[model samples]
Target: MSKPTALIKFKAKLSRPATPKGAAWTFLVLPAVASAKLPTRSMVTVEGSFAGQPFQATLEPDGQGSHWLKIDNVLREAAGVAAGDSVALEIAPVEKEPEPKVPADLRKALASNADAKATWADITPVARRDWIHWITSGKKAETRGKRIAAACDKLACGKRNACCFDRSGMYSKGSMGAPEAAE
Candidate 1:
């Protein structure tokens, strides 16, 4: 679908993640009301402006039913924004979903299984993204490995989606959301 003619606009202060202790990510949590206007609670791509600097990004769920926008170094520098600075944003969902890059491990697994690889190729980009997200969302190495194995098994069985996977992070007690503000 075409992006709405009018973009959804809001203002928020930048913040950092609480874990990792010294993470450099800068992100903003969208107001729940604004987030409700999006197509889905799961990850969604949008073209927008950050502090008036144009950008495009895939927004991630905040685990509390909202969304967070991450500002990469390039966008951060271009927007001239820093943590604690309130910035204006205007975004609209993109018409087409972008393909997610497959992780190396998942790539290797898919390569080894022809049936899984065929199903992976047959699925939609959004479905593939969901599979990738479900696999990568695992915080522990063992968890990720299990997810890759499960994904391959499901794909080999001709599963088109990550069944029962909670892409929004709302139903799952997982790491999702903007990083806590650093003191």
Candidate 2:
């Protein structure tokens, strides 16, 4: 299908979790624009400006049929926005599929594991993205190495991606916790 290029403009509130222990995430929940029904649980590249700072990111769908525009620290600082702030956003969906780059360590591990390599090749792009995300989400080198090993083991056993990992931010358990759970 041809990727639609209509510019979606909206006003969104910058929100963060109320709990102190929750992830320090800030984002904008985009409203439905035009006739396009954004896909659930998939990455969609968006090019836009949040409060005037240009940005390009792959927006992750929240299982509930909404997409979140995660505002990182840099973006927040640049935009001079914080929790409860309202900002104007302009975005256009890019048709290109985001290709998550495989870390060198994970690439080496996958190369050494023949079964894992074959399984990785057979899995869908979304599944591959999950595996790549899981492998790279580790905060430390040791943690990343362990995740890579675990991924190979799971793939060798015919598993497509990490178990219990929510590729969609709706129920993420990685560095950032579930967005809904924080609310």
Candidate 3:
């Protein structure tokens, strides 16, 4: 894919806990800016800079026909930004999708099950990422193992992706358990 010559730039206020039902996180991106890129997928990986600090993130649609780039704590600190602060952003589309790393145990499990492996290959990249995220996001080793086992079983049964996962980050409480304390 050819890269757009003009970098899309915008000034947006950093917002936290984007919505009451969404994940307790901060982000910086406007719908208009995102729309100009004409993303093919709801979630698109973007390479960009915020306050001059280079970063890469996936822009997720905001249900309201707009997209937002999640700003993690690390990026916030690096950029010296806070919620409600106006920040300048320069972004461009990433031509290639970065593959999420599959945990060793999960890899082993998939390798042993040919049917599951075949099914996994048939799923979309986004679906595969959700499964990987579900497995890796586990707070505990047991939780991760359970997720892995469940994924293998589901894949073997021809399931495309994990259900109940808030891939869009909306409706997700922090760490998939507790809600963020309202400010």
Candidate 4:
């Protein structure tokens, strides 16, 4: 994929989470100046180049009004960079929204309910993203299962969006923030 003309550009050192909560992933927190240039202080999709490798991702809010990018193992390998490496980045919000992959649990729930499945198929990709985000945002397995059930019930009732979900996590009780860096 071609890299978009960068609206924001900076160099940041990647870090790993101190706790087990997000240890599987590496993260880079955008500088305050760089993060401020993005469209919103919320989760937003952007197509960017990390260490010269092209990638598209949804940046998560850091709860400090800045956003942080999660660098998966694949990207890290491809980019030839790892935690503690300061790599160059260039990013811009995607003009066209990308569809989020449906989790297996949610997919199974929707498949079993004809009404929900039909509604899911009819909703726009953006709406589908909201539902998926709402479901996946749960911190526990039980919470996720409950969300899947709730999602199906709401979809069956023709709800087009995950009502009142705080995509930004700024106001929600479960405020999504960047994980603390490992010492």
Clash pairs for candidate 3: 21-171
Off by over 4 Å in 3: 1-6, 18-25, 103-112, 119-124, 130-183
TM-score of each: 0.93, 0.63, 0.62, 0.86
Off by over 4 Å in 1: 1-5
Tens digit of lDDT per residue, candidate 1, span 47-157? Answer: 988999988899999889889987887888888888889999999998788889999999999999999999999998889999999898788999999999999999999
Cand. 2 TM to true fold:
0.63
Residue range 88-145, candidate 2, lDDT tens digits: 9888775665567777888899999999999998987668878887777788999988
1-183 per-residue lDDT for model 3 (tens digits): 575645778788787762566554676556565556655435667788988899988776554445667778888889888887999888877767777667789889999999899999898777887898788878899998899999999999999989888764546654432122235
Using TM-score as the measure, the top candidate is 1
Candidate 4 TM-score versus the reference: 0.86
Q: Is candidate 1 or candidate 4 better by TM-score?
A: 1
What tens-digit string does per-residue lDDT give for candidate 4 at 101-156? Answer: 99998998998999999999999887898899889888899999999999999999
List runs of model 2 lying over 4 Å from the truth: 1-3, 19-25, 32-36, 39-41, 101-108, 118-127, 133-183
Clashing pairs in 1: 17-179
Candidate lDDT scores, in order, read 0.88, 0.74, 0.74, 0.87
The per-prediction CA RMSD against the true structure, in angstroms, equals 1.6, 5.1, 5.7, 3.3
Question: Which ten-residue region of model 4 has the weakest summed lDDT?
Answer: 1-10
